[model samples]
Target: MTAFILVAGAHTGGWVWRQVAAGLRDSGARAYEVTLTGMDGGGGAAEPGVDLQTHIEELVRLIDRIEGQDVVLVGHCYGIHPVRGAADRRPGRISRIVHVDVGVPEDGDPALKLVPDQTDRERVLSLARENGAGTLPAPTVQEWQRWGSVAGLPDDALARLTEQAVPQPLPTLTQPLRLSGAVAEVPTTGVLCTANGSSIAVVEAMVGLGDPAFQALADPRVTFFELETGHWPMLSAPRELVNVLLRAAAGKGHRVAAVREQPTHLRPFLMDVEERPRERTGRVDLHLPDADGPRPAVVFVHGGPVPAGARPTPRDWPAFVGYAQYAANLGAVGVTVDHRLHELTAYGRAADDIAEAIELVRADPRVDGERVALWFVSAGGLLAADWLAAPPSWLRCVAASYPILAPLPGWGLAGGRFRPAAAVRGAGRLPIVLTRVGLERPEIAVTVEEFVSAAADCGAALEVIDVPLGHHGFETVDPTDASRDAVRRAVRSVLGHLRVGTD
Candidate 1:
């Protein structure tokens, strides 16, 4: 019989996995819910010296005692640190390693780095030091959202989780996990919790960014499953978690394609147009029209969460260059910009960069300050929300191509700051153009549909150009006549809007 070892995240012990353990047992599998050292019912405050290594040793001993049985080790959130350390040590004995809603950290990476927010990390460290203890207290019930989304949890579950939670050892978060590289050979499964802001689509996007760090995710030995609940699926959807675990153990889950030598965005643009000379000014590049006397301008915003070290940034990309040149040929000044949208959390900084770029473009002697259109693509689409919320008179039109109108679940964006769908209600009299593809990812397509519905409900002047057989980056990926025609139509529509007040 196959034996499963379940490890919970910080502050909680084996007790958190009670329902999951019982569910696995009902399926004729042996389940062991582990409470790491220093956690409640697992030596607790008595083991003040408990660190990451101590937790790893605890799991290693359990795996050693389960003689002659196939072991599948499961780790949730912070528990992944020790689970990976243990798996690295016993790769030959482990059948599969299941990672629940957390990224697999590299050797020497501390759990403290996984917190994401710098403020929260400092707060955690301060709390541990001020308490005069070596432990960080669990977040209160009111503060639970800071840890992760509590979308599917019931009132009872929330209260129970808060009541049963214990202070976490400081060493576990600060101490790094040591790996000998053996765990890379072990089959791996990733259970992504979509409601908590992680989804396979996001993983695919990361891989598409041409980052070497994300390339390993395409390995055949690794697979993925997505849960529609928040972080704690054991409490919110135990039965579903059990079912997914069973399927994962059987090596049946979604497989992400390997990164191609050339990512879709890097492919050549669909439209063919004559090249125009571009004048580089700071971060913005201006492609001026031949017969220009203060020509109307179109600012092309590229998609991101791009790596900080990416070569030949967005402004120099083939599609951006192609669109810029095409606009210049159409008697309009084409502008492309480079912004520091290096991560999902850097949207605010990117927005500021775009705003600065626009101001510079408007001030240029070769561009018309009164007439301008904003064109956003892919992930950059969320940046359009600000302009749509309260468009200035100088802003003639806004256009998006395969845009993410709403934030994805795991992004953790608060309020309507970057949500274009919510801001569409305030887009009175502003001409908005949207280009959508048929073969887009479900997660992104849903956001597009939501924005469309909201625009209709609010009676916003929204124009949608549908590419029925195209993919997300269809301008490059699907370089058919349809793709070229769609691009031409979108450019024409935006240029038409720019000319409305001028003529």
Candidate 2:
């Protein structure tokens, strides 16, 4: 039998792992729940001196008491810090690490540095500083719920959580992690919770565009699985969570360079894009309905002429799958494709890829062919100007979200030359839904206004969706209720205009 040690996140204790341990024990494994020194309310640890070192030492002591040779160490959220620190200290005793909802750590990274968004990072830093002593108070139950955890949990569960949660020591968040190269040799698995909308797939999409917070998933040794719940999977999704853990512990879930197996929730609607060699020119993933007659299809183009050294695989980004899945749920065939990122001919190559992708989708027997729509996001919108200018007869609608409508200073050689104003004159007569971010950079707004003026003057069919207070990458930056509602409305409007089914 294998020994499984569970480590809890900040402000919580081993109590959170009780249900998981019960599930594990039923499967014939020894499960040990760890309560860090300060968090377990013992040995004067409640005082202000608890830091990263204190928690790491606690885990080391636990492993020794168990007298285990092959240990499967599991960590959730903030618990990753100590779990990883201890792994570094005793690499020979650990067999595999399961990073649930949280992620594997890189040496020298403090907790705050791992947070992706700037606004949220600053807010956390401010909160830590406000505590006169080196500690940040835990959120009340209401605050935690608002922050998107324990989705669909019962009242009793919520009450138990509230009673057990405590303020986390600030030094743990501020202290840098120290690791030896030996820790990287251990196999690792990452579980992404999808109910909050920031699934592993969503993070990978940001990584495709070079988001540093998600770069860890790109590691070859890490295999990822998605759990359809909030951040607290053990509380809300114990059955599914436990099954995944059992598979990981048995060494059955390692995907080195393969297409991800579809999550159980998405298997009914989605089909992965076939994987090809890294040098393959173009690729697209498809999402379809069960009925299987010719269905309306919406093609998605992501933003980027990726920088010099930031190379990502075609199927790596989750936004493509997420949007495609969203379309499938709405009764439309959803397609997300990749285009060439050429520096000299940035717009030219990506536009050509879009054209090629549309041709392919139109020829597919599963797609309605005549009722196809195009969705362009960010820089990909700039590449799609020509398609919007001279759209095909089958093109019924077009939606551009936080798009770069016109060229600006330092834009590539062809950027200033390709004009949206001139292109609108010959554009096909189609309903164009343009979504603008209110809190975006000043220069982006200026360019978008220029294109809006040109499209309106040319008598083009257009409807504007202004996401006030939404940032440039609002969907992923921070999906507030208002922002999500705005994006959903924009998607619905585009699909409705295309006459796509919503069953």
Candidate 3:
């Protein structure tokens, strides 16, 4: 039987999950409402000397006991600390993680570090020191009602909660969560309380913009669900919360890019192509059109130069595969490859990886060996600038989207810095098409526009599609109607260019 481990938030114990755990058990699953050492009762002798490490070890010990069985670990509110720490230590033990109305922590993040209300935080800490012997006490019943934590609860339920809630260990709130990327591979679901009417994109964009603490929400592996209730869904909407957790456990809420989901019009034309037949540079899923003769192939390079030693996930495959499938459906061999990012500071090896991928894709019997095009996204466009400067006999055109076209501080390269603007001066006459998001990233938008202007000055037949309403990484992060339309038009234009010689 599968199991669900329910971890409660600050000033809470396993008692908070009583209804939720019972609901899970009634639904044919084993459930455990975990209480950290000091948070077990209203007031206990074991309430002293507890820290974040103690809480993390408690969950880890539970996982070790339940080894060899499928488990879904859930974290609510401040419980995200222990759950994330345990997940990082034993990622394989848990099949999925459900974050119920809580924020995920980044490596070395402590509680309240991301909180903006300094006065409120200080008040809570002062109250803990004064009343609970260095422990942060639970909010009063009236305070819970006023703060909306008990918004939809009945009077008796509210009273029970306030009576049972215990003081949280102060160390747990102050200790940093130590972690590595191991837990990053774990699939996470964010069950958001949307009674405030906040969408996932809006919330994530706000948090990701400046705060490194809320930055973990941007991880592609995270799938989101919104419930129309206040903060404490376990108390306010347990049944609905359970349903969402079950869906997440069954992997139903994710928006993954699988090859079979291609549109009907594109289905018959699409065929999966492996970009590298015998290399460890990572595989790219190529979707090629089914044509009678060899067709022009477009080698698609995706945006990321991921940090050193990070494992790639299926979330990383979607946007590029989507574009490749779109290109394939329109009569071209669309190749998408995950080129190697040599080091965090350099990308010369990425160039070699792309060159190898292009050659591998071009050599395929279904692809016309003499005709090829280049499609690059984000930083990939800058990496492909070398090829753009020295056009091959077979290379027809190049298309780039929201690309980082110039090198700035921090984005170091091998041998020398990334200077795409300079590279464009020598790019003889290769026709280039660029799609610029209106809500471009502050770091590279100006440089990209300057590069485009420089390329046009150097006599390259350049076309710029300006999507003023689109934001940086909109193709993947926030694919608006306008952004999708822009992509369709760009793909058609590039395919048209590639078909010139063959037609």
Candidate 4:
């Protein structure tokens, strides 16, 4: 299967990739537009806190589930910074790099810190602050003129851009790119955008400074191209951009234009007092949305339930970090805390630990005390289901994946997991479940079966989906069909259920 993963620049989301995606499909390639975190409108905005690593995690997640062995990655504007890191994570996963109106000029260092000293990028922060902690519209042509002349955009084109502009989350501009080993090894090409040459900080500066890193891709693994067009290629020149992308997909380089839309966090974090503690320490990384409106918070429990504060080996794998970032991107505070032997030795005692954490977060004004959700991975799902049994008003939704029906009469197991026979009698909304068992692991078959039985007995709405994947670990990465369907529904359902709590 041929896959094309397209991403937008700052001030835009995956929605902008729609028409171009359609065009690509009509031309016979499977294409997907990705809306990176901090871009979408409903999710709100970042705090003085959002950074580059956060943005990269979101993009890598989109790259994870792509069906083809390797995809042609197309990133525009600052998006190139993050996708390059993603390419670093999986050397062969992305076969080609298409930088629309973006170019490496040089490898120098990771692009994370390659920022402009001018006000062009900083203006977004002022806009977001004025708008109350959310994305603001991109500068209009009239607005762009305030900085410098946009060398080439003509009349009608420049006029139409103003109404369509949206504000960008400040982090995308401020965050510097973080490089992984995969990035250093991947083959890449840059499609330098110069239509509005005078307005581009990098392009206009190139006359004297040369490439940012000085012919960074001079090694055997890189190439370059220059395109003359306005920044919004999808809208300004969809056909031109599509044709450019098609060539890149075919292993060449080109530039394109497009249009798009664009995207938070604090804490009452100290309340979870562990009395019957295990030999482990827990760290809760809560990302509070920035606003007075009632927002939701998510508790992230990894699938393997690894030790607390231990980050996955990001440099070695493509699936690390994105899990927790998912919740943060959605304007929900994310608490990826660690529970030790308590979660393993005593199930009930372990669960209350999470409950206390919820109440602690509710102490914050940003979270609507009544509209919080809990999101868990494989084994974590079992624990979350059990905890939600007597959930507080704030614990509004539950999203569990590949959960066990019962290990020991509703027990969560590190070993022999068969769906628990437990029942959650709470009136909380139905859970969104994503489960997949290895074709060879029959217990995987019963994983969802057991969850279904418990949901029916519990009297809650349950959206359960099964997949043909060989292992239970697929949901954490970019998801396949069965897994994505379940996760997408679960995310939507959890958001909806949280609303119910607010009511």
lDDT (CA) for every model shown? 0.88, 0.71, 0.70, 0.53
lDDT of candidate 2 over 407-429, digit per residue (tens): 54323233233565556666756
Expressed as tens digits, the lDDT of each residue in 1-503 for candidate 4 is 66888877665667667778898998898898887665555433354444556666766777787666758888876678767767777667888877765554223343322222124434455664565344445666656443222435556656654544455665555444555455666666666444433122232222212222333444445555555555556666677677777776565642221111100001111122112211112345555443357567666654332333323211111221334344445555555555442223344444666666666767766566766677766555656655555555556666665554444211213332222445455535645544445442333345566656666886766665555563444543324566555555555566666553334
| TM-scores for all predictions | 0.85, 0.54, 0.48, 0.42
Q: In every candidate, how many clashes are there? A: 2, 0, 0, 34
lDDT of 3 at 421: 72
What CA RMSD would you report for each candidate? 3.6, 15.6, 15.0, 24.6
Better of 2 and 4 by TM-score: 2
- Judging by lDDT, tell me the better candidate of 1 and 3: 1
lDDT of 3 by residue, 1-503 (tens): 67999998877888878888888888898899988888876563336667888899999999999856589899987888889899999998888899886666888888755332344466656755665446765768865532333446667777888888876777788778999778988989888775422346445433432334444555556678877666688888889888888888887664422222332212221223333222222455567575668888887776554443333422144566666766676778777777675333336677877888788877778788788889888777778668766778888888888887765432323222356776777667777778888887555676787887888788877888888888666665555677777877787778778873347
Candidate 3: misplaced stretches above 4 Å? 42-46, 114-116, 124-133, 145-149, 201-220, 254-503
> Candidate 2 — what's its lDDT?
0.71
RMSD of 1: 3.6
Reference-based TM-score, model 4? 0.42
